[model samples]
Target: MKRTMLAVAGALLLGACATPSTEVGIALFNDTVQPLMVTGNTGTKVGRACAKNYLGLVITGDMSVEAAKKDGKITQVASVNKEVKGYALYAEVCTVVTGR
Candidate 1:
């Protein structure tokens, strides 16, 4: 009975200490968008950018839309995409800007 009580207490402690995480993992979708042309046979390009999340509260780093566009050498954006990869206590929010 004592062992069972200890186990239950341990479980409760661990559960209480656990941090809530949201939107963890890769997401191949856009959070924002603009009107742009995506044509076939055109040269495809991709730009990547990342932002860091601290303690699930503070966010630091650069994941600018313009930066992604520049990285892909895109004058006129065809489409914008995003990817989010994260783990316990930290996260990396990334953006993939695609263009022709």
Candidate 2:
């Protein structure tokens, strides 16, 4: 019985740490206008962007957006792709920005 309880606790802990991630499946832009300068692709990992409590409450922030823009060095956003990683206890989201 003790061993079973310990096993369950371990499983719960691992589950809480497991992060489920996803990305935007669709394109961000439809216009055909070409950019004068094409910047290289860039990605940034942002954490604490969201969180879930034991009661299923959620909170979010703009850290991911700011980080992505800074990393990409983008002034004018032409297109954007977003990837989200979520955990039972915490969450991390990444933004992939492209274009000039």
Candidate 3:
């Protein structure tokens, strides 16, 4: 009976140890875009790259620029195709740092 109790406790502990994918997903998104050039990259490029990398790390859901915009997840608006898109997004993200 003691062994059974111990096993149950261990199982519960192990189960609780399972990593939470939600936080990881958000972190993954933050990490992917955090290091990029927030000034040089266009908004579209930033949006696409950020979404691709962030969503790519996860096992589910679409990560396109349109999807991001649709979901209102992109705090900055990027161009649809021009390099300016990425640059715009970068500018938005780096406003505090660049003051441009």
Candidate 4:
């Protein structure tokens, strides 16, 4: 009984430290783009803000629409997108924003 309990706990903890994935499906190396939102107008300006993870240990970045908007110098938000590229050990998550 103790062995079974230990095994279950170990399995749960094993995935707890796994790196984040960008793809919706299960893949070791995933690079995917997902649409977040769309307004009536698709603005002319475009910007992207990214955050990165290291070995699933350290993660840092401003992956926010506001950051993207600031990067693009946008006033009104017309659309938003999310992009992810993950390689088991490292990962990059980005927010893409478009506006006027």
Best prediction by lDDT: 4
Ranking by TM-score: 4, 1, 2, 3
Kindly report which residue pairs in candidate 2 clash with one another. none
The lDDT values for all models are: 0.58, 0.43, 0.31, 0.81
Quality of model 1 by C-alpha lDDT: 0.58
Residues 1-100, candidate 3: write the lDDT tens digits.
9999998876554433232223234221121223212444244323332221111223223544455455444555533331111211121111111111
Q: Write the per-residue lDDT of candidate 2 for residues 20-51, one digit (tens) a residue.
A: 33332212111122222233543243212222
Residue runs of model 4 more than 4 Å from their true location after superposition: 1-18
**Number of the candidate with higher lDDT, 1 or 3:** 1
TM-score for candidate 2, residues paired by index = 0.39
Clashes of 4: 0
Better candidate by TM-score, 1 or 2: 1
Pairs that clash in candidate 1: none
Which candidate should be chosen as best, given TM-score against the real structure? 4
**Residues 1-100, candidate 1, lDDT per residue (tens digit)?**
9999998876554433233333442322213333333544344788767787645567776888788877788766656566655454455666677776
RMSD of each: 7.6, 10.4, 12.7, 5.7
Task: Please give the range of 10 consecutive residues that has the lowest summed lDDT in model 3.
Answer: 91-100
